[model samples]
Target: MRLKVFEFDISNSVLINTQTQTQHHLTRTEAQVLEQLANHPNQVMSKGQLSCAGSQQAVMSESAVAKAIFTLRKYFGEPYIDLIETLPKKGYRLNISTPPPEWQQQLAQRKKLIILASCMMLIAAITLITAMHQYIWFKTAESPVRESRVVTLNNHQQIELIWLQSPKKSSQQVSNMEQKIITAFNLCPIVKWRDVYLAFSNDMQVLNISMQGYSSNGELLVRNIKTSDFSLQPNFISPNWLQEVSLCD
Candidate 1:
């Protein structure tokens, strides 16, 4: 079901800022967290409830669940900090008022449908589609804000820099080049960091990066930077946006 978490729209596996209207991807478990909180709006969802969102990461570890919430807060920034409330040992809840009568009926239907869908594939498909509408019944709701839309990448971003010197190069040189980019960012362990998007632009003379870093002191800084910052040039095809490359090896 979809509902407004502050100015952001909470849809399953996705969060859209109503004003900007840009979609944000949610991990399977994070989606589960929002789903449960939404299911019992204004009511506490015990840690156990949030942890058992029932995705591949079923029964998420406490730390994992915490991380998901951290990510959520970081993305949304400060204005709606109280969108999710914590009740000590009780659990976390969305600080929304009770939904309307029709919403009550829809919730009932969702429960029934969940019980009826026997196939795993069909269930996944439905969950994906279920995000379309949420019938939250509340009056004097916050009006939508207007802001420039920021696009979200479809693929998981793992690194910060891209090379654009030449499309034909050596494998070792390419690997080394990627390492240099990854190492350039002085990422701190205490801060929340995400690799937004890295790509070559301007006739392969510069690299463009859109990234966000949330400091431990609760400062969020975003930069859309283009730089000819690299000192190394490697041969080989350039990396595709959001596809290819596994740095774990």
Candidate 2:
């Protein structure tokens, strides 16, 4: 039942910063308001909605919600306080602008990979031009149907999650499989991959999950798992299995 916001633990009426090793116990009202905001990060929420969420009444004064927000921001202190934004006429929005240090490092590594790939592609293009006199035959294979969804993080960054449908499986079967994968991912404590791909076999006997991203050392890494070797629950993928495959550490 715990939810994470970057390094913060937004669960059990407590706010914890894992990086700083600091814990802040929240008031009942504060916890309710913060949970509402965390559950819908980056979206504007009015004070009335927030107050009613905490009080569970038809109407609570906006001032109570405002006070709760002020207290939460005060607890956040300095730079982190900016995570909760207050709009004069609109409402409050939880917009996390800063990403963790490891995330920033990962992004830098990805940029280097892109540059190296571009250089390789340029060299290959030049080589192809020189061999233009030779007939180059290329055979293209048909690709499986894919449905992509962009998962937005608390920090406003996005990662693409793609589901590749097996030709033999019905549309409903593929959609249900994708939902199970998504649920497991959503429950993961830490997600470092830039993209994820889930595919099924033509006979529906094998299921493959691939996570594509660069490791800490700037090396391209693909983590794979298959149902043939792993047992899945009737409803969702196992959280332990996800952490084992999805995380490099």
Maximum-lDDT candidate: 2
In model 2, what lDDT does residue 175 have? 70
Q: Stretches of candidate 1 above 4 Å error?
A: 5-12, 54-58, 99-249
Q: On residues 93-188, what C-alpha lDDT tens digit does candidate 2 reach at each position?
A: 988443459978899999999999999999999899768735565556556646888877554446787877567767776677766665655555
Report the CA-based lDDT of candidate 1 relative to the real structure. Answer: 0.58
Candidate 1, 87-141: lDDT as tens digits: 8888788887765799888999998887777566687867766764354333675
**How many clashes (backbone N, Cα, C below 3 Å) per candidate?**
6, 0
| Leading candidate by TM-score | 2
Error of 2 at 103 (Å): 16
Candidate 1, TM-score vs. the true structure? 0.36
lDDT of each: 0.58, 0.70
